[model samples]
Target: MADSPLPDKLDNARVLIYSHDTFGLGHLRRCRTLAHALVEQYKGLSVLILTGSPIIGRFDFKARVDFVRIPGVIKLHNGEYTSLGLHIDLQHTLKLRESIILHTAEAFEPDLFLVDKEPLGLKGEVESTLKLLKQKGVATVLGIRDVLDAPHLLRPEWESKGAGAALQEYYNEVWVYGDRSMGNPLEGLGLPAQIEQMTHYTGYLQREVPESVPSKHLLGVPQNYLLITPGGGGDGVEMVDWALRAYELDSSSLPHGLFVLGPFMALAEQQAFRERISRIENASLVTFDNRMESLIDNAAAVVAMGGYNTFCEILSFNKPALLIPRTRPREEQLIRAEKASDLGLVSLLDPRKGIDATEMHRALQALLKQSPPRELVADCFLNGLDKVCQRALALMPRS
Candidate 1:
């Protein structure tokens, strides 16, 4: 790829983001956050995100920040890919996604093309789009979260996917959305120096309190309650179960628990969770909330599985949190939880060891005693959004 010269001036630049939202809400949420931040920073800039999230319509979007919903696909628990709500083969669904992605790129003609998580998209679905954009000299960036997974797991996964070669061949820049002090997503990948030179650590994206909030009636709970969220709740059943067990074990004078079980949780699991929580007087369950930042901000404290988005919110809102990270499928959350615990940002509770009601009860009590994240970290730790805007400007055509 040839170096694209920096332009002389800025104008109504356009940006396109691709989010291969196969499993959880993380990819789509991250892309949406960036899209909102970018358009807010640049007056005339518009960001159009291409996502495969079935619930994309559920989330609210600001003006000049919109999404194009491609054919939705989902990842099954057994690590198989299948179309979401469509009775078709996975290959056909992938082909449809790829065509829509390329078509959107051609029509949008964005000045900057940003991709979230998957370097080459799900099964290299975005490979052709990236190549076409590179040929057109559209600046391409790969945005990744703080921790992908354990090195052992990530290495084989990337090797099989040819992520390193794609990074070197297609991307103009790689943005790690995390502080290097916390963790590096690309730590042991052993990519070439060219990829390293083009990479930037943009820190974690900061979340803000939403302008609109759900009323107490809508939330089915009052303020100043303890928030328990298993982000996206697909793999969060354990966390939720543990929390409920804790409450059941000791219905002491602890804070009221409000659980946001996430949207992707299985129907049977959700029903079971509801039944369990119904018996617990101090706990209330909400299956999902699109505007979760509000709940996080308003909480007295938080108990959650340490997903990337939740980590950002915990810091952004400076809440005292206890993270019970999952260790299977991927150790990304576990790695992040360990790092945050080391940094004194949050407390860690590994479910691998044991999540008995007694242990969970102790953790809940400990959460309130822990200091808020901002008190421990520097004030500038939440400057990821500002830095990302600056980096976007540098990569974008100013003319």
Candidate 2:
């Protein structure tokens, strides 16, 4: 048997990313984007992601990067969790996930460790690994989205989950993937001074336009179309339905509409959407698009749920967008959308405020017909990956 390469013998910088993605594609996608950006900026870097997203394998990874899929845990809409497609008990599944995470960190011995979103991870699953990393003197950073939630909810949740303590004791830094002038992800909860000082606003991770994408003509779409995307589509039925309803009123509101119904949308709901899509002469629907950035680049405008990743894309492309943000479970999206609107970056349509097809159509018409004054948001933050790569390089040991 061959001996494993010793730590000093390894020539590449290793970064281990933990994305406890209980649901949706947001966290995994962000981590993967950061990973790719890091590899690009810092040559001879190897990346490994520990992810629990069920669809982790569906997306392709770049060279010198891969993932170990942790046992899946599903978080229901009502804030409950269960083993995703696993016959084992939830506790066992979590234990198995924890074991794999800790084992991977130990074996990988990465130069830096990045934890996405949750500070202690889902139900504190990554606590042991965090502790071990701390003892090993591994540089640790917790990467948080632009919006966490309403401060009241975040305070209680962090307190009960010991997230604040974990942040202070284990991690060396916390990077918010947003600009501070936009909104603080930690605004509501009064974090201790030390921990607060540790947080750095890295700005938004701007997605790069793909080198090549199918042309609008080749994709069988008109020259101009409003791109309607509900992100992962798990909680996107309302947005998709509303867009279709808007089209029913006036197809001219948007000359053409291309809807990317995420794969997580329920089959029955998608079928219902397909029925509606059939009725709208100028609207198109695709169940999924692995490279959504390409579609974003080609689209004339955007209408979306205003998730963090989607907002980043809209900012990157400077797309005139109508954001219909959900205000349930967490008000992160709602708050972000409102803030972005105030900054003249995007417009918002709060779904809960008695909005209907007419309202959606009005928003759509405004977005598609009128290009937003891009100059207002000309200074918006979009170079997060660059800043993050710099910080990581500074923090990395002399490997």
Among the numbered candidates, top lDDT falls to: 1
Q: Model-by-model lDDT, in order?
A: 0.87, 0.84
Q: Which stretches of candidate 2 lie over 4 Å from their true place?
A: 1-10, 215-218, 372-374, 378-380
User: How many backbone collisions does model 1 have?
Assistant: 1
Model 1, 343-368: lDDT tens per residue? Answer: 98889888888878888888889887
TM-scores for all candidates? 0.95, 0.95
**Model 1 misplacement above 4 A:** 1-10, 212-220
Error of 1 at 76 (Å): 1.7
